[model samples]
Target: MSSAFSLSSGRGRGAARLAAAALVWGLATAGTIAAAGTATADEIPQNQGGATATIGDLKTYGSAVIHENGEDSWVSAGLFEMSVENGGMLQTYGVDLHSPTQRDARYQETSWNGTSLSGNAKAGRIRWILENSYPQVNDLAALAGKAGVTGLTEQDAAAGTQVAIWRYSDGADVDAAAPQAQKLADYLEKNARDLAEPEVSLTLAPAAVSGRPGERLGPVTVHTNAGSVTVTPPTDIAAGGVRVVDQDGRAVTSATNGSRLFFDVPAEGADGSTSLTVQASTTVPVGRAFTSETHSQTQILAGSSESTVSAAASANWAAKGAITALAAQKNCAKGGVDITAANKGDAAFTFELMGDEHTVAAGVSETLTIPLQEDQVYDFTIGGADGGGKRFKGVLDCKTQGGASGIAAQTLSEPSPASVGGSDGGTDLAETGGSGLTPVIAGAAIALVLVGGAVVVLVGRKQTPPQV
Candidate 1:
C-alpha cells in the first residue's frame, strides 16, 4: 500500500513516446519548480535620490591647537553644511570633516545604513555649540569678552570657536590658539546641551514590487550607515508567518550592511505586503553623506555623530503582473496587435493599453485588436491597473526600418505541467484516474510510465508521433 502505481494502457496515437516524454518532462520541470521554491534574490531598484549637494561660503571658524606628546597643531573648524535629504536644510554643523571636501562634491552621496545608540554624548555636546554658542549665536564680541581675551581677531575668533567644538567632537583636551578662545571653548562645553541623535542613517531600496500568491520576488538589499541592526520584518496575514525571510527561508530579525533580503510568500497565500522596518544603535560610518534629487546639494555628516536610526521598506504583492506582447504585420508599414488572454487565477480584471480598457471574465478568453501605423512604432507596455484578479499583460512591436518583423506574444507565467488537465488518446479521464503526478508519487508513476513507454515506442516507430 505504501507504493501503489496504476498502469495506463498505451493503446492509441504514439502512446509509448508520450509516456517516456511525459515521465522525463514532468520530472525535469517539477525539479525546476522545486528549485525555484528556495528564495531567489534579484536586484530591486534602490530607494535613494540622485545624491547631490550645494555648499555655502567657508570662513575661518577658529582653530583647535592640540597638545599630543607636547606637540601642537592647528585644525580648522570652518564649514557648516545642511540638507535633510528631504528637500529642507536643517542648519547642520560640521563635526568631523578632516578630509578635504570639494564644495563641488555635493553629489557624491552613496552608501548609507541604519543603527541604534552608538556613541556617548560627545557628538551631541559639540552640536550644542552650533545651537547655543558663538558662531551659532553670531556674537563674537560678546564671546571674546566672556572668554576674557583681548584682540580676538576675526580669524582667532573663528579658530577659537572651532577649537572648542573639536574638544567635544573629537573628545580631545585641545584648546584655541588664542588664550581667550580657550576660555570660549570652556564656556561652550560648560553650557552645551545634548540633543537627541539623528534617527535616519540608512535606506531600503525599492518602495514597491509586485508578486502573486505563489512567487518569490525581489532581492531587497539594505543600505546602511550603521555597523549593526535589528530588522522588524513586515507583518501581514497574507504570509503564514511574519518574519523577513532569508535565501534559505530563515527569519532574519537582525542583519548588517548590504544584507540581502527577499519576500517569501507561501505558494497558497493570498496577496499582501507591508513594510519592513529596522532599527540600530551604531556610529554613522565615516565619509558617508546624504544626496539630493532636485539639485547638487548635500550634507557631510559622517564619522562625527552617533544615533539610533531606523528605516522601512515595502513592496506590492499583486495577484497578477508580467504580460507578454505579440505582433503581426500586414505589410512593411502596417502592424496590428492581437491580445489573446484568459484568467481563472483570480476575479475579473481589466487591462489598460493604447488608450482603451478591455474587461475580461476571470475564467474566459478574450481577444482585442489594436492596429498600429508602423512609422517606427516600437514597444508597448499594457499596464495592469485593476487592483486584483488574473492579470493579463500584452506586449507587441513592429519595425519597418530594416525589413519584415512581427510581434510575438508570450505568457509571462504559465501553469505547471502538473496542473494541466486533459483527455489522452480518446480515453475517458474519469474512468482512467488520469491526472498530474505529485512529487511524492512521481517515482512510482515513473516506473509504470517507463514500461508503458517501452511498449508504445516499439509499436509506434513507424507511425507519426502524437503531441502531448
Candidate 2:
C-alpha cells in the first residue's frame, strides 16, 4: 500500500508540476501566450514613423517640411500635400505715391505659393483679384501688369505686370501666386508701410496625430497602455482654424490658421479638457470674379483598422473625445465602439481617457473631455469579455467631434466580431487562444511555465530509485 500510495503521489505531483510548467511557459513568452488561447486581442502596433512615397514637403515656408519617411499611417500619406488659401485685409493710409495708370517700381511686387510645382502640378484653375481695387488708375494698371504680362507698348517704356492671388468662396486674385511681388512694387512707389493686418492664408492638411484617444502623449504603457487616435479632414470642408476646451467649457489648446489636433495618452490624475471646434472659413473676396469652393473632410486614421459607424455613432458627448476624434458633433451614441479577439483568454486594454472606460456595445458611442493641458497624460482600462465561443475583444472605436474645420473619425462598416471590455468591468470568461490577452499577461504566463519545468526536473531526479 505504501508503494502504491507513493506511485499515485508521484503521478499527481508530476501532473501538477506539468500544469505549472505549462502556465509558466505561457507567461514567460508573450508571443507564445498570444499564439495560445491564453491571450487575445491585437496589440497596438508601435509608432514606426513611416509614410507614403508620393507625398512631398507640404510646408512652403521655414523648415516645416512634411517628411513622411518613417510614418506608418494614412495621415502621413495625405499630409504630403497641403491645401493653401491666401487672403489679406490690408489697410493703407497716408500714401498715394504710385499712379494707377503709370508703371512704377514702388507698387511692383512678387509672391509665390512658395513651390515650383508648375501649372501641371497644381492641376486646379488659377484665380486672381484685387480686394480693394480702387486706389488709383496708375496703381490698378500697375497691379494688372504684375498679374500677367498682357501687353507692352513703345508709348509706355516700363509696363507693369499683373499679380495673382488665390481666393476661395467670395473673392478673387490678380496673380495666381506672386500677387504681392507685383503689388509690392506699386506699394513701394507709393511709399506705403502697407501695415496689413497679417495676410490670411488657410493651409489645410490632415495631420498624423500620435498617442491614445482622450489623453496626452506619455511613455507609460503598462497599466497605462492606450491606443492611438487620429484627426482626419472632411472631404467637403477644410479646417481653417482649431481650438480645444475642457469639460467645463474652458479653452485648452488653440491652433492658428494652419494647424492640427494630435492625440496622445495623458498623465494620471489629469483633468480632461472639453469640446474642440474647428473653424471652417473660406476667404470669399467681396466679388464673384472667382469661384468659391466648399471645403470639408471625414477624419480617418490611416493604418488604423477601425469599425464601421452609423448615424448613431455620431453621438458623442465627451468634449475631449470629440477633440481627438474630430467629430463635427460633440457626442456619441451608445456602443459605438466594437471589439474583436484573435482568440480568447487574458487580455488587457488601455484607455486614454476617463469616458473611454465605457465599453462599446453593439451600436453605442460615448464621448468625454480631458482637461486642457497639452503636457498632461491620461490612461484608462477596458474589461475583458467572453469570446462567446469565438476569439477577441475591447473598445474597437470611440467617436467624437471637433467643430467645423476639424478632423473626423472613420466609420465602421459592420458590427465588430468581438466584444469590448473595460478594466473596471467584470471579466466574462470563455477559454480559447491567448491572442486576446495583453502583452504583459502573455509574458508572465511564459515565465511561470519555464520556472515550473525547472522545478519539476530537479524534484524528479531526487525521487529516482538508487542505481547502486
Candidate 3:
C-alpha cells in the first residue's frame, strides 16, 4: 500500500518524458503479455512492446491509513482511476507506486502468471483475493450490506477492495476508514488462492521461400519457448525422395528453438510449392519486475491456461524443364549413347556435358554421343534455371541397331546432390543463412477501459515480460 496520490482525468500520449526522478514509479514483473487492438492470442507480433498506466482521480472511502514499519501513513484507502492509452479507466488498487504523486503518475505494467506466482505467496494470494472479493463478485449492494454498510458508494467499495488487495499484494497491514470496507478486507484475507498462468505462443520467421528445382530452399528457423517442435511437410516430398533437412542437409523429424530448416527439392520435381508447419505447446512460469538491475515487482493478470501454437512456412521451386539430364542410346553407332543437357525455359543454364563445361541457352539442347568400344556407365549433371544442378546416371551401349537396348534406367538422382553434400560439381546452389527473426510471446498491453461500478472489468496490453 502506498501513500495518497492523484492525477488528471484521462490518458494522453504515453511517450511522456521519463520522469526525472527514477524512484517516482515502479511496476510488478509481468508475465504472459498481450496488447489491445494489436496482437492477440490469434495473430502474432514480432516482439512484445512496452506498456504503462497512469493513475488519477483519487477517491477516499474514509481516509484509510496503512500501518507499515512501526509508522503509519495517511493514504487513500484504495480505488483510483488508472488511465491507459487506448484503454479506459479501471478502478485500480495499485501494487506499489513508491511515493505520492500529483498528476499523470504511471508505472510499467507486469503480470504474475507462473506456478509460484512470481515466487510470492502474497502475489498469488492477492490474485485469489481479486477473483473472489467484492468488485470481481460484482454484487456491490449485497456485498456492502454484508459488510454492514447501506448505500456504500462505489468509491468506498473500491477503497475496501484495495485495502484487502494490500493485505496480500503488499503484505502491509491496513486499517480501513469505512467499517464495511475493513470488514470485506478481513473476510477476503482469510481465503486467497492462486490462479494459473497462460500457455506461450510463437511464430516462424520468413514463412515463405523460393528456389530452383534442384536447390535446397531454406534454413527456416524456429522461434519459440517450447522444448521441441513437430515438423510436418507434404507426403509427396518423402515419397518422391525429397526431404526437409537441416543446415547440413541431414534429416530430422523434430526441431527445437533456433533450429534451421530446409526443403530439398529433387531435380525432377515439378515446378510447384508446398508449406510445412511446426507446432509446439508451452507454459510461461511466473513474473518479477523492475526498479533495479536485479529485482522489482510483478502482477498476475490472469492465471495461465494451456494452449497450443503453430506456424507455417512455404517452399517453391522452378520446373524440371528449366534444367534436365538425358541419356539416349544411339543404336547404329559403335555401342554408344548421346548424353545431353537441355534448357527449354527462359534462362541460360550451365552444366557438365561429357566431362566438359557447357552452357545451354534457352530453347537450346547440347548432346555428346560417344562411340565407345565397350558399354560405359556415365553420369551427367545439368544446371537449372538457377545455378543448382541435377545428376543423371545411365549405361550407354548400342547393340545390333537397338536390338537389345543396353542402357539401364536414366532419371533424376534422389536426395539431390545439393541436399546431401556438395556433389553437384561447381554448379551446386550456395547456402543462404536462415531467417533469424523470432516472434515469441510478448505484448504491450495497451489501453485502459472501465466496465462497471465496483465490477472490475479489466483491460490492458502486454509485452515480453521483462527479466529482472
Candidate 4:
C-alpha cells in the first residue's frame, strides 16, 4: 500500500515534521499505522513521505493563547505558536477552544529567545494598548487589567502558552522593547541605563511642630509624581541624609535612594511658630546598574522656626537629544534671519530658521532662512524670550523686488552683506565679523527677544539706531 506520508520542501517544510509527529501519536495511541481495519480520523493527513514523528515530539519551545466569547461563534483560538528553527522567523499558529464564552483570537509576539511565545486578545483592544505604549513592553497582565479583563486569572498562563517574542514589523524594530531589552543584556552591560539619584527642594509654611525627634513643623508640600505630597521633618534634621517625618514628626517613607535632609521656611510667620523652615534630602541605592547623582535646594524661613522637607532625584542627561532644537518660527517675505556659530551651543536655536539666537561656537557659519512681509521691519532680539540672561548679538539682512521712492521696488534684489543696522538715515551698514546690523525704512522692526518672556521693541526714526 502506498504511504500517506510524503516529504516536502520549501519554507514550510517544517509543517511536514509536525504532521508526521501527529500521525505517529495517533497510531501509537489507537491502532496500527499500516492496518486498514480502523478508519482515519476527521482531520486525516495525506502524507507523501514515510516520516515517523509523533505529536508529543512536535512540542513548541513556547506558545501563547487567546480567546473570547461574546458572539454566536464564540469559540476559536485568537493566537497560537509553533517551534521555529535556526534562531527565529514568523510562523502561523492554530488551536481549538472548548467554551462558548470565547469569541475571537490572534497572536502577538511579546518576548522571545529561542522559544517562540506569543499571546492573544480582542485584536482591536490589544492593538490600541500597544500603540499607546509604543516602544514600551507593557506587562501583559497590566494591559489586560487596563482593558477590563477582571476575571483573567493567572490560570490561563498554565495553558501551554508563554509570552511571545515580539519583533517590529517595520525597520524601527531596533529600539522596540523586546530587542532593546535583549541588547541591554547582551551588549550594553554596564554602559546602559541606571536608576535616578534622589535630590530635594523644599518650600515650607510655618505650622505647629511635634514628633519623636521632638516638636517640629507641620505638613509641607514635597514635589512628587503623585502630586505634591505633605511632609514634616524633625527639629534635629541635618543636611544630607535627614530622616523623613509626618506632620506630628513621625517617619514615613524609608530613607533610601540617596535621601537627604534639609528644610525651607516661608517668608510669612506661623502663629507662635518659628520662621517656616523646610528640610530636603534623598536616599541612595546601595547597588545599581548606573551611577546616580544627587542634588537639593532649600529656602530658610527668615523668622518662623517651622520647617518642611522635600526630595528629588537626578537621571542621565547624556542622551544626545536630551537637549535639542525645538520647532523654528516662520518669517515673512523679503527678509531673512541670520544665525552664526555663537548660536549653535543652545539647543533651542538649532531648529530656528530666523534670528541669531544661538551663539555661534567657532570656525562655523550658522545660516538661517527667514521669510518676511514686504516693507516690514522686525528687530530680532536674542537673549531669551522670557529674559533669562542668554543673549544673541547679530543683525539679519533682508531684501526683495518691491522698492519705492529712494529705494526702487523690484521683484528680486541681492542681499547687501551688512553686519549691523544703518546710521543717520544712511542705506549702508557695517559688518563686524558677520555679526553686524542693517537699517532700512518702510517696515516695522520686530525685535526677537530671547530672555525672560515677551519680545521688547526699541523703535527708532527710520534711521540706523545704536548697536545693541
Which candidate number maximizes lDDT? 3
lDDT of 4 by residue, 1-468 (tens): 011222222111111111222322110111111101112121111111011110101112111111112101101111111121112212121111110010111111111110101112222222222232212222535533443343332222211111111111110111111222222212222122322222222222111112111223233333322223333333422212234454444465433222232222222322111112222222111110010000000000001111122322110011111111111111223233322221112132222214222333322334454433222222332222222211121111111111111111000011111111111222121110000112222354533222112111222223222221
Candidate 4: lDDT over CA atoms? 0.20
Off by over 4 Å in 1: 1-57, 81-92, 97-102, 107-117, 145-157, 198-314, 318-468
RMSD of 1: 31.3
Instruction: Using TM-score as the measure, name the better of candidate 2 and candidate 3.
Output: 3
TM-score of each: 0.34, 0.18, 0.35, 0.15
**Each model's Cα RMSD:** 31.3, 28.9, 29.5, 36.6
- Any idea what lDDT model 2 has? 0.18
- Clash count of each predicted structure: 32, 167, 33, 120
Per-residue lDDT tens digits for candidate 3, residues 291-331, read 11111111222212233446666554556333332223232
Per-residue lDDT of 238 in model 2: 16
Candidate 1 lDDT, 323-437, residue by residue in tens? 2111111221223334444333345545555444566664455656545332212233333222122111111112101101111000101121121111233311110101111
State model 3's lDDT.
0.40
> Model 3: C-alpha RMSD to truth?
29.5
Reference-based lDDT, residue 342, model 3: 41
